[model samples]
Target: MIRSHSKLATALMGGLAAGLLLTACGGSAEPSSTTAASSAASTAAEVATSAAAEPITLRFIWWGNDTRNALTQQVIDLYKTTHPNITIETETADFATYWQKLSTQVAGGDAPDIIQMDEKYLAEYASQGALLDLESIGLDTSDWAEGTVDAGRFDGTLYAATFGVNAPVFLANTSVFEKAGVEIPDDTTWTWESFAEMAKQIQAAGGGEYYGVENLIGVDGASKIWLRQQGAQQFTSDGIGFTAADIQPWFEYWKQLMDEGGTAPATATIENQTTAVDQAFLGTNRVAIGFQWSNQVNAVQNASGQDILILRPPTQTGNAADGHLWYKSSMYLSAGAKTKYPEAVKEFIEFLINDPDCGAILGTERGVPTNLKVREAVAPQLDAANTKVIEFMDSIADELGTGGSVPLPGGGQSETIQRRATDAVLLGDLDPATAAEQFVTELKAEMGLS
Candidate 1:
């Protein structure tokens, strides 16, 4: 998915040693009238102090860059101030290595108390009995938008709580278009054909300085949209939902873009595959348009130093109704099923999801807040880039189609497989049809459907 608080010093414990010693030594002696009241009060105060709960330590882990890590630490510090009894230890890693580390941790029976989850792997972990059911732990989801609460649900149980909602978006660098003397296409009326044509024109106008668009054949997000627009899904409750025939056209479209010089060359696109967001073709100003999650607009804009515009991905029919766009959880907050501090983890999650302070600090780093109240509270404070993202999502709120299906077990492997197949086709190692067929076969086998 899109993928800091101050540290409070430990509070000094009240002195109870003297009070206990006095109680033990003063056995049969009654205090004088003048000292009786003071003595009793002191004794009671010490008893209360001794009875106070000790601090509970919680471990939270997530995948993100230094920016996200710093912001999250601030939130943790803020939470600690109010919840002095809870201490949270955080671990962070980049997206590429996160799952590998987490899997190792889980295998060693030492998963973090709080886990930052993605839709792709939520089911994988949940089904394996690694995640706690939020509902069972008393999480409040009443304020979340419709279907958002359910995004982290599997088999009718809530395993994770959505951190925020996002949708696939066309992040257009408007400055690039203007420089190329090309007009931005109207998203509402644009089709796949028009999209390609616009890309070709932009490339032509740029005099080879920039490609028209980033190559998206390897992106699972783009593939999902393509499948959804065909009235199918990448996965269903049963198995692979779309046939090889359905995916061939998607591959064919990218081939056409490459042939027309509308997208980066195979090698450039492959190189872009492993590039960071800040170093990608779009971020580095090598393309006029690129596809990304809605929440990533700010980062791309900051990286490119351009007037980034958020547009709906083009539909097959050039109509909003035909577009397969829908709101999805950018990520989720899940508690470990085996956590020793479930209540503490639950409270932390609740704060992260519903607290305005958390929302303000987090902003759209994850995505727009899933909590309606938090979303509204942070609206006025958003930067220009985030404001555009909010506006874009609002403009298409009613037009979104049904949300995507829950990815099945082993579904996390689909993206890598798709990327490999896309690379093969773009490199002429496989035709679109052959790549599509191989993709389906590999995906079905990975998901244990065959």
Candidate 2:
């Protein structure tokens, strides 16, 4: 199974801490007006002297929506109540803009003290000596969710802490399925061929204007799962793990789906990805099935104004374990290598990961907290969509896949290569076999391989 931890530990990873102190007057009774005034002044002076340290200002940065932003600000405010000597400044942006701005900041040596990281750039920044070693700096991971402690490490060195946890999910729009009069297949026994056939059925109902799904050809993460199911990997620590033959069938699988009218036309297939998420086929409710991260069900619902059902991805052997789905970090938290206040950063990471109050305030806005205790603490407050997401995760607890997925140095370019080659094949400019070969060759070049 993908989850190395026991089912109880895997689904729940039980987990979250903070103490604020208030000064109390030492006197037994109220004193005279003059005496009171003198004592008050003395107490203030004493407090100031005791807390004496250069006032620390930490710049914390992340990418998220209004909900996440509000909850994050609340958490920051709560932390400051007990920390008069520390001040935290915050910066937030959408996903694309956040990466671009962060890249520029890092390049110029002005990166924020605490940075929210994505898997795509974790390697890029950590490899360049931009991220701090969380363990060496003394950030505790004992209470974190199972299988998550090492998620942010590279080369056996810790570099990041998980922010939230999610996994790859096959999403089906129930509203669309109802409209087409097609029954949602049983996810437990579904195979890739049957999944494609279901998509084709939906397309027949749409009469060519709408497709049943997006082409799997250009989805890098799902593509990784496909390779993993076959006991190969899309990436390795040093280089690509699969040869052209291993992935050639994958390209052909998508070609057959597209040929059978299961997906959008090749041009629309590629163009839809570059558009805003809500404007895409899945979000717009043009498709019945597609792939999405587990936590993204809410966004898809908001865009489509329809209910979405999260399904285990179809597998080659009609077994959930064969799907090779694993729990993945939604994002990560890392301190800048040059952070002036390492101790303060450690305290902040501790509170964020271990405090129950923080969990209650933040809810599932950042995805489910990796600490199982936090998930339970925040469960009552999550809305219907988020509740569904939680339940779905629990149902598939025992089927999680493990290992075989380790992003290499240049693996960020995997998406670029996949898109280009997929476009060529989907547009009929190249056959599936030719596109697969080119995909491998181009990826090799990008990663500096021979």
Candidate 3:
């Protein structure tokens, strides 16, 4: 939500490399007279020199692509202007590789001073003592988004800080609706049955393309929605939420849709050539509806040259609890448990979330700005697409169900249940009921739950 007139530059990748080299030489090498006095009371600051000195250097690292890396550097530069004595070292990479490097650093006692973490890994990292307790570092969470902060906590102690919220939204091509002679329904009250039925209707009234919607069994997000509808969580406090019986009904639901020709064939999901943003089948007029996060609607619409409207997921109850999408931190910033300058690292995180310039430069790249103050500051500068997302989320704020607990402690295999559902069905190893039962058992076992 923080919108800055100045664009953020992505220089952290290079800066981080330099920081690592300096770290190799050891932080104790020599304190430049410029290094400020450490006023931070945390243990990490205990080793510093006189309080009259300038702020010391704090090394931070995170995973992100070109845009994210650039914006992060811009924010850091802005922070440096005000707190001139403090220096921040940053690193970045794509999501998958980012974790690999972070895990290694954690094991080697050289983890970055600050890390950009994800919910899927939050519990695991926090449990392993790889991260610092955020409260110990002087972070104030009184103003961050509720869900964002909650996502970063482990065992009731806040360990990280978050910056935004994301929700699943249905991207629709209004032009396709007109051509197919179909009317968009009041999504608030529409049920999954209604959505499936409507897709059939659109296919019957076909104009150009496969049908009214294209969803895939292989899509993890979609599977999450179905899992929620069945009154199960993705992962439980102990581990997997449901047994194989629970998975069966959901698999059968999708299988029925696929069998009825209401969605694109399985081959399409596996073989489609499309960029993450373009969504080729939906953008090129081959499908009318696509499931994506609200943050992605703009890119999808831009590629298609169509009027895109975000709609609520279809659910049975008018009460709406059955179809709510919980908000999450776009990413979290946590300190390495082994860092030599924990206070500096904590200060760097504080500046990133609370500084006006940092928030503005961040804009919506992290999803909606998690800071209430930042959201207000950046609202005026938002583009139409971004503004729409803000307004939509505000409208549904009260309607969202409980954000729920953080994901369980399974590392790489946390999402396995969703992935294996179809395979279990296709291989004839078990029926839907049996598959669901086995899924629950495996998930619990992986989570270390009895």
Candidate 4:
């Protein structure tokens, strides 16, 4: 029941970022000119200076859009200015292709010095001994979200360090709700049945102008939340956590939503699921409610042009704790365990994560940072969209729970399996029970579980 850092952030926010950054960057307070402390500081600085001046070239690979790729390069260039002799070659790929390419490189024993890891596949790589033990190498997690750093651990060893934390939340369009003449549900005490009734009512209010809810069938977050509420999960340490019996009700519930006119049509719903957040049905104002990671509130809000209500998902019971809401790592940076330049790679990572200059240069493209000082330091410089995200995450601090874990290796492919089964159910090619069986069967096949 260990929780990720949330309210802990408020506790640490009192300290100013300047002094924290100074300390992280090795800047010492003024000491007596003749004191032993002064000499020690000078010796440390000289050693650091010597290391910075040594010629070291490291490669970093990540997947992102052009903006992220560009920002990352900007951070790399900034690092060069500080460490004049360090050279970092960069590689970038889109989300879909990055894992396959990284897998190929890893299998060939040609992995880059540093990698950008997603929670889904992190365990696979870390378990394969592909990522460096970040804890063993002295990367600081002092300012990060409590217990949540375990998101990057494999068998209790930290292999990666998260940039920040995000949660799965229901994004409700206030404008749509007002227009539909329906009050948003009391998410703190709402049940799944209440959620269904609310969606149906909203659709009835709209009279075909828009949908009440985005189709939840194929959306992975919805399934994860539902599974959690049932005391199950999408994945566990060994394999897929829920069986056909456990998941059939989920498919049936959403299928009921569709039959009752609470969701978009199957084709359009499937298409919406595949598109970017800003272009999804919810973002385009076609759905009154949607599910997304908390970090995506900015994108959806900007697209719909509203400060949407960020609500926790309804649970099996009316209690908020029954919702099993939890914080998830947005993403992480890991080093290759077999890296030749381990010290240089660690230094570069420390700079990107802990340095004030890096926090400013990288901005929040990687989601709001988990570091308390970095979050505070860069808060003022961010736009309203990102600022609102920070505020919303803080507001839900107490509701955040635990039990989120990465899929087991090939279990990362659960999204594809779930999508296929959902399409079958929605398109009438398979019944809910049948689709549920197929979903579990395929997932087990993917994970190579008996």
Candidate 5:
């Protein structure tokens, strides 16, 4: 939900092209004699020159801000040096307006050759036949990070190639915990009760700032994690999973926290937001804790200008071990289904994932690295903030649960369901039970399910 397109599309695409071309040509050449080799070299040089003379242009579109845009252009420049024959036409927009532009492009049948996609819209776009099967383009998941790779899969096939990894994590300001005299437990062993108790203690600490957590009843916030913990996914295996009733308890939990004064006041929670960390209770030091993805540690830390440490999501006590929240692609790269140069696009994706120099240039702007080799390559260059993220995520690697569940199905108005759930909780128009019932009803109606 937080838009973090680093404008590294050109670098990703360029590296992909060069890597693929090199892969194709370098693997099977034969040795030649000196006299014959001289003539052969001459002929090969001529062909290379001709290929270089005709530039291959790839149109790439993504979302980000000015810093990201400038970084992207620099990457493009680096990529062009290695791939002299390839020229990339860059298109970018802020996160708010990206979908509008992409939708128009899709409608006009002029979508860019390479597209950066999100999970919410992936099924819709892929089912519309707007995206190419990444597997068809020779990009396989055998080497990609499992969670990120899974996020790109739709139905049974992969429609996009992931750019990086994102896992839901909490950022705790240790200063708040110390001031409150509340001990921060190791995330792996902390349960819901322990978390609630900690919140209560933080509230008891004398300060204008309240206790432990901030409320996040909105979609892409607490609700998603709640659904996962209940062993009821947001959308079904076929994409019509749970309804409003399924999401009500998640809202109730926050209401309970608010009533206890273990979190920011209800008024502030309502005003605060999940997308904007600066608008979060924790950001204003109104609360000690906030729920968000690991990559957001920097944003929250920067907003609060305080030291922050990553914590795992609180575990459900009696629920079937659903594990921590699901990890997903920060974003994905897909080839336009209608691209005139499909092979080239495919090659571009492969490069983005595997090319060391490109991955180093792109860094972890998308989140953390999804490519094993690239992760290693870029590890040394990560800043203290990003390095902390990488280490925290990796520390919990063995404990992270599986999200091998099928991709959400298509033709079911899934996004509408998510929005409605968020609205009901934040607006307080409906209690948990009513919301759950309404959600189920709407879901069944949308899918025409029994």
Candidate 6:
């Protein structure tokens, strides 16, 4: 699910103000440089200037908070220092509004030259010819890990470059565990049943002060992992891969957790599920365990003021080998298909992916570096939290399954549907079996399969 904040509201109001200002000014006013050059010598200079290298202005757009924006701007500045003829203008919005604005801009033929993309929408845009083929543009991927380059492919063409790689992880607040006098379960050998039992124990020990884990029934990431564990893809080349039967058990599992007091109450879980990272159950020390992307470890630690430990999600059959974990592109960078300056955009993407200096500056904020060389070079410089994430990822490398399927055109709506269905189940409006059935039906309709 996309997290929201007051920043998005501020950005929306700013956009409105800019629109009103443009209306007041009656659009952009032109300068009369040509009319001022009356002398032959001045005309000659003007002609020469027109023939010389013109400055290339590229507009780039992304979704992030102030920290990411600052680091990205630094990288852009570094690039500009070397390529003085190129100029870059950046626009940013919170995750909740980024896609809405991007879709509107693209439809109006005002898309940015460079776009920060997510896996959920990459295929949706690429399949519609909105994104450029990176391979065709000659963006280098030779330094990237093997098969990592394929994360952004659609119909055998590379539409984007993997900017960073991550995987879903269970983030345990060690302090909370210690306070409850509960030992962290061995992730390598833990099954879903054992996981629930552990959570129940933690909650029992906390005396209402804390919960064992955040209620994750509505979390799309958890659903994906569950599907993978069942040897099912979330999306296939054909359509949605899992059936109602596949989904029923997942809902049942979480319902069981709620019944056993292993997680927060239904209403509280629904509220916390959508809360911002800094104020969520895990972030506020209201829960001992929670789920998040691996890249979020540092941020969660910073917010909670506690030592956070990353663990592999529980598997079926109590075996790590049965886990269907895989490395995913945390996000991607794609050039606009309609960009006027494709070559310059491609150059900038190349620098972002392969430059050691850029890697140092970014330092896993986006994710672990996609470029293997950069990953190796920046290892010693990472802080303790990031280092733990890196180590966890490396330890699980051999256990991962194949990469996940690309999300389909309407795939973005699946999370919302999941949330609604899960809410109905938790509120006693629908049983697990009926909720699962309704979920599949709505998801099919959303993906145009119904």
Best by lDDT: 6
What TM-score against the true fold does each predicted structure earn?
0.87, 0.85, 0.79, 0.82, 0.78, 0.87
- TM-score-best of 3 and 4: 4
Alpha carbon lDDT of each predicted model: 0.84, 0.81, 0.69, 0.80, 0.69, 0.86
Task: Name model 4 segments beyond 4 Å from true.
Answer: 1-52, 361-364, 380-382
What's the distance in Å from true for residue 130, model 5? 0.4
Query: How close to the true structure is residue 183 of candidate 4, measured as C-alpha lDDT?
Result: 88
lDDT of 2: 0.81
List ranges where model 6 is wrong by over 4 Å: 1-53
Q: Is candidate 1 or candidate 2 better by lDDT?
A: 1
TM-score of 6: 0.87
Give the Å error, residue 92, model 4.
Answer: 2.1
The CA lDDT at 308 in model 1 is: 87
Task: List the pairs of residues colliding in candidate 1.
Answer: 4-71, 4-72, 4-73, 4-74, 5-73, 5-74
For candidate 1, write residues 261-304 as lDDT tens digits.
89988998999988889888889888999999988887888889
For candidate 5, write residues 381-426 as lDDT tens digits. 8788889989977877766554434334332354456446545655
How far in Å is the alpha carbon of 347 misplaced in model 3?
2.3
Q: What does candidate 2's lDDT look like per residue over 48-90, in tens digits?
A: 4226666777788888765567678778767766676677777
RMSD of each: 18.2, 19.2, 14.5, 18.6, 16.7, 12.0
Of 1 and 3, the candidate ahead on TM-score is 1
Which segments of model 2 are wrong by more than 4 Å? 1-54
Cα lDDT of model 6 overall?
A: 0.86
Global local distance difference test of model 3: 0.69
